[model samples]
Target: MNRLSTNIFRRSDALKSKPDTSAKQPFRVRTGFLILILSASISLANAEPQNQKNEILAELNAAATRVETVKASLQVGIPHPTAALVQWTEALVAYRKNPEFLYLKGYQPLVPLYFLLKSDSDAFSLFVPRVYKVFRGKNKIFDTSIDIDIALIPQDIILALKPLRINDTDHTEWKLAKDQTAFELTVKDKEGKILRKIIIDSSEHVRYQVEYNDAGFPYLEIWKDDWRDTGSIFFPYEIKMKRSLPKKNELVLKFKEIRPNEKLEEKLFQDTFPKDAEVVELKESSG
Candidate 1:
């Protein structure tokens, strides 16, 4: 469902590790890359299912109050790690400034919107949907048929937004302000995972303090914490995401500017292809 958004990579050099144990490792097969094969759509799994409809309506009663945090919870599961030819973490980190390839990024609301989560091998996807056009990197004039399932944020507010995937629970937690910010929580199905902790600041402007414990590894810290007043509410201006445990993979995105609640052209939401482009076959991930 969200193979388009995870930004997973296929680094050639990562396939070579020391000792050269297996002189003949078959074609590079990265579990991480293969994890992206499983997909998802807008109709996400929110366990709240039937009841959440009522909850959303109930929250709309005031229609003028604040809602706190929002999140996507997916239990981390991996049959095995990716088969990289070598351990290239240090090499990649040293010169990753120039990534050979990049996945097309989708939408992530400056303001909290609903998220659709699809779990893959070890990696997962969460996306915010809308009707819009995306210009290709090569030709800015050409429009592409794209339904992105991932979003990015710059580093900051790692603490403010306590992102978590606990062993138990369906809803992620965000400390709601007194008629201020609130959230949509996400947790994992891992037997002993503890939820990440985030403290929301709803004073004049909103901010957070997020932290957590994973497999007894101490990884508690506040990150890229910065917020801006969006007239009606407050939101993080700087945000970042990374692997919380077992690994140090990361994704960082910065918002050049944010335009809110704009109308979408009906044509964009359709599967029509623009002229000069091939009609790509898009599979349906949802029933």
Candidate 2:
């Protein structure tokens, strides 16, 4: 009887020491693992486009902040209803609304024209400086108030990217498209209208841009080439511009020298017309 009790106690101890083979895992373990993997894949895919857009915006902001003012030589070709008048001259083309003046001297009588675009109004005004007897009455012929269609503000590549960086990001939308050879970015408004379309090659810099009108039609196009870096800024030495409305015209501006961020006075941007000269206001439409 004593031997039988000892064998039974040993058997009971052996049963307690055995592993719990009957227990089961949680119900959703496998499913949770699969969902986690899918979420990670989606996050990686979405991050690519966002990264590309941020890179482009950063580049644009860097270019815009490099200069406060610009002075260059511009050759403008003005197309009349009948003939085209081509003029090559030097200009102080301010980038930050400091003041812009075009000095035309290739003609028999020199005419110095100043350009002012009022942000308060939807129009841009042109005025000539009040000339004294030095012009020999030749200044009167050019002393006229000319207003052209305000469809698009005529700007170079550097000035053109200013609004994109400064304005509210919610008002802007960026879309990317790519082909086998090149890539393009279309910047749109809140209403899904294309404001500007930029094209790039392998270098990934802006090579060309087409600006649109309110009706979503291409109004002006700019092409930039021969980029030069002036320590503080990088700008294109050769710029070509073409317009599609009002009067068909083309301008090729070659910068023989570019002066960036020159200190200018506040009085420069104000109207500098002579008080005695008769002011004639002329209005032209974008049509």
Candidate 3:
């Protein structure tokens, strides 16, 4: 009986020892696994500290290239209107509200224009600067109160704009028939009226498309949207503007001369309003 009791006690001790051994093995394995996981997470967290500066600079370089290509192509097709130019001018007269476009076929469309004078029919234009000079008859003349877009403004303005972003690849368009490089942009107003569409010829940025609303602001504009040079210099040479939405009217322009680096007198930038001309500056919208 004593021997039997001793055997029973030893068996109980063996069973308890088995459980402690198993528990210790599992605990050690768990601790090792946790350490490995923590190390991996810490290494991954500190990988790249750059603020995407390299990526942004690369994009800027590409954009500058696109603009440069346009500037170089400005002088290629000049000395009067090409076949495309004639068609563009014809479209303007047939759809133009000003009627002056009818006899001005020889003159290229610089920028769309309309009178905002309170005394006049309350017209407005795109945010583009106005031109006091025009190609009249056989001579380049100054037409006072004449709604025009000066070349200097368009050339300089295109460069000054901060490149907002590359448009989604989807909405982008090209007129391969006229020139493969021309790119067109179209934006709309809250009323669903076509607000703006402009085309820029990539081959020659000088040629561009500046669509005009009935009010004469570009509803769409395009000029040299691609194949830009490494620099940001640009000019609109061949332009086409289509009035889309409520009405359908289209105007195209061909530049006889597009000088990107033209030397301009500082006085040109100032408001040289005539003494008799009634000039009232419109305050910016509070909204």
Candidate 4:
């Protein structure tokens, strides 16, 4: 006989013992009952961790939903590693969700810079008062000349302040830290490429986040601190973003005033530049 048949015959001979007639039950039935119990125990043990992950995800979504609109006055700091002092400027930023609109006005020394985004139409406008120029475009936000402008992307800015709501389409996996003080949540796209990874503390506040580029490289690392309670939701007063490629640069925003869920005026989303201001329509390079 083959090895497989010999093993089966040995198992059959092993169960050929006399049945326990006193208990009024067959041994095989008792053994089957034990196997069923073991299977149920294993299933429950596997379900518990998944249940915890679901609860954590629900809490994150609940917090994100509480933020509808936010308007803040902030101090923008660009740090130079070689220089002794950091370049500081002031800015006013406002954004609203559920269509996604953002308006940023930066007070530069030479002139004020205005950036507006309307996600519904995928349109963006940049106004530079110094040059009396207004550049309007669609799809792309910045030009190739602006190397350190990734931090100024409207979507990234909004994500840094407001946490993204985990949706059904996003593949998410989380694991608790060894010390159980925090958990790391990794969100990936349908193609299994990591979109972003967030670290949340015990209080469910996002401590840090790493955003990946299209080529699956870490492009930006963000650290959030000094959370402020804005009644409706918790807002991070201090946000620092570190760029990894081309040249390492850091941009920090210190929010002086944060107002959440405020009713923003419609005019804020519109372009109110002077008619005489030279309109420069930025076209996408065919290359």
Candidate whose TM-score is highest: 4
Candidate 3, residues 74-172: lDDT per residue as tens digits?
A: 211221223443322211111111211111112235633321111102221112224432221211111112243222222112222222232323232
Q: Once superposed on the true structure, which residue ranges of model 4 sit more than 4 Å away at CA? A: 1-51, 81-84, 108-120, 139-151, 177-180, 245-249, 283-287
- Residue 121 error, candidate 3, Å: 24
TM-score of each predicted structure versus truth? 0.29, 0.56, 0.28, 0.70
Error of 2 at 18 (Å): 72
What is candidate 4's lDDT per residue for 1-287, written digit by digit as tens?
A: 26645655565565556454424334555576568768876665444356567777888899889888889999887787778677777898888886777777778666556433343356666666666777676634332333223335555566677766777789987766544567788899888999999888877788888988777888778999887787878778999887664346678889999998899888886657778989877664454
- In terms of lDDT, the poorest run of 10 residues in model 1 is 88-97
User: Which 10-residue window in model 4 sums to the lowest lDDT?
Assistant: 141-150
Which structure is stronger by TM-score: 3 or 4? Answer: 4
Best by lDDT: 4
Task: Please list the C-alpha lDDT of all candidates, in the order they appear.
Answer: 0.31, 0.50, 0.33, 0.71
As a TM-score, model 2 comes out at: 0.56
Report the CA-based lDDT of candidate 3 relative to the real structure. 0.33
Clashes of each: 35, 1, 39, 0
Q: What is the lDDT of residue 171 in candidate 3?
A: 35
Worst 10 residues of 3 by lDDT: 93-102
lDDT preference between candidates 1 and 3, better one: 3
